[model samples]
Target: MRLVPIQSVKEGSILAKTIYDSEGRVLLKEGTELKDITISKIEYLNIYTIYINDKYSDAVIEDVIKPEIRQKAIKKVRDVFYNLEDYNKNQNNYQGQNLYKKSEKDFQSVQYVARELIEEILSRKNVMIGLVDLKSFDDYTYQHSVNVAVIALIIGMKMNFHKYELFDLCIGALLHDIGKVFLPNEILNKPGELTEEERKIVQEHPKNGYDYLKGSYDVSVPARIVALQHHERIGGQGYPEGREGERISILAKIVAVADVYDAMTSTRVYRKALSPNEALEYIMANGGTKFDYKVVQAFSKVVIPYPQGTMIRLSNGDIAVVTKVYSQMPLRPDVKIVYSEIGTEINSIMELAKENSIVINGLEYEVPEDN
Candidate 1:
């Protein structure tokens, strides 16, 4: 299967992966032929890219969690956040009232999903982190929460967190953005720069989310703190509070990196998504400043910048597709040069580690200006 931009998708192509909405509803299933209507519907939904069948491409992308389990996790996140949103519509938490009321079942449901994700991920010690999930503009929050949790769990495992600590981190990372549900939809979905006043309101989401989760009887304090401090940077520049390095807890620091990585890689209304390599570079660049150094280091060791099936450009001016990924050497994945510089078909696969001279120069989804 080959991933392609929605604009380049042809009507007769077969979907290579199932597309799910925020509520775990399947929009389109794998192997289903994309007709004019389905293509149009996908575009209308604001989905930027998708995976489709390509006879010449042998690249395969794998998810750490099963599709059924991942979908349920997304649904669980939806349930927890939506229920809180519904409850908030009636109560006034601004007056120091506890937000969650009889929320034990809801909290436990999220914990169950988190436990499932942690177990599934830990079982696959070699699972490479790939930014391949399909999500729409409207599905951003629910799906993004799940993806962030997955990424955070992987990074935590790489750093060798204790079993109990991993559970707290997983739940904390999953509900990190639970505050956004209380914010106005207009501001949350705005496609342009925010005014200073608007920015202040947007900044309240972390504390707002913290307050909401703090009142929960089942939610752990460490998990609730993740919602509060995920926005806090190590260099004292982040919002809500200007906390410095070591002052932040290790759990929140880890979730902070995970939160930004997925948010940067996931396409949003305001900006196009950064390529996986590009996002990794950004985290690496700001490791000591905006993010915790240890967390960023763990992120690099765990994630696959170029996963299988990625179309990339080589230094020799040839267009190639990623055929294999080396977890320890993320920048040097084995690639098959499918076409020469002038678009001539070559179909030659080479291990980048052995070919010391040929380097990856570009990504297919790379933004024009970014290139």
Candidate 2:
């Protein structure tokens, strides 16, 4: 079976998957055959339509339904953070071994954790407040660190970084914020503005994190350097030593771009969270001064500004939700929107191609209630 846009979907096509409502109501079950009115009415709904034959099965669902496993990995990382005291006693604090092993052992698990983290951060406006209820700040930190590592890894993957180097990059990115453990909770969670002294203290986290990892674990120099120099800027205005330009390691530069992008898109005490596109714009604007230009471009290619499952408003008096992203045109992907022009929910999906259709002039980060 082939996934086709609703516009070209012919009648007699079989339903490939079960259609569910926002309230979890099963609107249509698998094996349901399409009628002409059903297709036309659902076409107005601007939803995704899959053309299926007898051979199509639920194999796709199995691949997409692994959030439970991802959550398990997240819980394990959280445990490490929660039991940092034990970890430290066992000589495991800030050591890069944990980060490296987790990534090497389970790259998919790491990627899923990162994807969930990104969705949560983007959805919630207050980062610290949103994270506070997650039981352990340490786990939150670890999960976030892992998230950043995966982000860097994704960036590196796009740049064709070697597998070993990619693994090292993931390890370094995972441990990039480890020094925050030594920081005072008051300073870290301060809702108000931070003083220069407090800012300086915060800036020391990279160096401190690097020290903790280097001394505790037997990680490579690139991994250690990434933790230390991830904050160093291209214009020699970053933290610790402010080493300029090529003096910084490539891994450090890559992590820096991912780190700042995640931080900006994440909620902070002093400001509201920026949307993904907004944060990317900020990174691009300051590319040469605050970030590496090539890294920023790579990041832009890897991360979709409007990720899947996000709701968007169309010009045709309808609300559409992104269901999938197309590699060729990342911005214009497949969307599934609810419709009831005939007083019945014409549940289906739509593909927004740049070829010929109502142009999607606006985009949103929030998922719709009826998705």
Cα RMSDs, all models: 3.5, 12.5
Q: Give the winner by TM-score.
A: 1
Q: Which candidate is the best by lDDT?
A: 1
Residue 327 in candidate 2, Cα distance off native in Å: 2.4
For candidate 1, what is the lDDT? 0.83
Q: Could you tell me every candidate's TM-score relative to the true structure? A: 0.92, 0.60
For candidate 1, lDDT tens digit of each residue in 1-371?
77777887887888998987766778888989999888988999889889988654655677779998999998888888777777768665445544454567888999999999999998996666886577778778888888888888888888888989999999998899988988998999999999999899999999998988877778899999899999999999987887889888888999888888888888899998878888889999999999999899999998887878888888987777888888889899888766675444477778899989988875763312212
lDDT per residue as tens, model 2, 193-287: 99999999999888877876665434567888998999899899998999888989889999898777767655444564455566667888988
Candidate 1, poorest ten consecutive residues by summed lDDT: 362-371
| Collision count for each candidate, in order | 0, 6
Which residue pairs collide, candidate 2? Answer: 47-348, 47-349, 47-350, 48-348, 48-349, 48-350
Candidate 2 global TM-score: 0.60
| Overall lDDT per candidate, in order of appearance | 0.83, 0.60
Identify the runs in model 2 with alpha carbons over 4 angstroms from their true place: 1-139, 268-271, 314-318, 334-371
Deviation (Å) of 219 in candidate 1: 0.8
